[model samples]
Target: METNRQDFLKKFNEAFATSDVDFILTAVSDDILWTIAGDKVIQGKDQFASSLHEMASPEPMKLKIRHLITHGKEAAVEGTMTTPNGKTYSFCDIYTFNGFKDAQIKEMKSYVVEEH
Candidate 1:
């Protein structure tokens, strides 16, 4: 079960760079709340989907995950994403799952900083 959750989180984080909206949505709950630190907060699947589309780029970003930690119903992922234009951003996302088994992300808080 631990390994399963870890694999799930890996794919979920990678979905962001791949623009795989459907996969992301499926991994989250219907009433999911996403807070992008210093940016904006998104609630519900509809808003989440809209935000995903708005942030989607023509060329997929490259993601390099540094760490992934999970315990109980909480998880955190740290990574750097490099855009097609050569810009890189370091990000750490904290997540809360709906349950321990067959979990779906119910809340997420993201802290992202652009690399100079």
Candidate 2:
């Protein structure tokens, strides 16, 4: 069960690099809340989808997952994303799921930093 959840989270993060909005939306609940630290707070699946569209880039990002940790209905993934232009950003996202079995993300808090 833990392994499956970990795999799901890995795919979920990879979807961001590929800009797979449909998969992203499908992984979350209707009332999903996302807080991007120092940026903006997104509420609901609709708003989340809108934000993703607004931030879509022509070039796909290269993502490296450094660590993935999960406990109960919570999880955290830390990684670095490198843009096509050579810009790299380190990020950590903490997630809360709706439940333990067949969980869907209920809330997410992300912290991102650009490496100088």
Candidate 3:
């Protein structure tokens, strides 16, 4: 059986891959704080969906997950998102999940890094 965090991350990735805003919100807390690269911060599910739509608009040439690690209440993921324009953005994202109940994520804090 997968851990709650692992399950959440898997579902989150699936939602992202398909641009499913509703599914994303189901896994994310209502007050989740999502910080993207380049100083963009999104709060709440609505804002997350909007920001994600804008970010995902570039078209998925490819999105690859390089690594994922979890420690206590925190997790980090490294990945590359290649846009339709042929721009590859390598990123590392750190996340903190507050709690889990019924396998649902209660809160989260995300930090992002972009490759130079």
Question: How do all models score by TM-score?
Answer: 0.96, 0.95, 0.72
Model 2 CA deviation exceeding 4 Å by range? none
lDDT of 1 by residue, 55-104 (tens): 98788899999999999999999999999999999999999999999989
Superposed on all Cα atoms, the candidates' RMSDs to the truth, in angstroms, are 1.3, 1.4, 3.1
Count of clashing pairs, candidate 1: 0
lDDT tens readout by residue for model 3, 1-114? 667676677667656656676777676667778765568678877787678777565343466887777777677777776656666667676776665443444444444444
Report the lDDT of model 1 for residue 56: 84
Model 3 bad stretches (over 4 Å): 1-4, 58-61, 101-116
Off by over 4 Å in 1: none
**Candidate 2 accuracy as TM-score:** 0.95
The true-versus-predicted C-alpha distance at residue 43 of model 1, in Å, is 0.6
Show how many residue pairs clash in every candidate, following the order shown: 0, 0, 0
Lowest summed lDDT across 10 adjacent residues in model 3 is found at 106-115
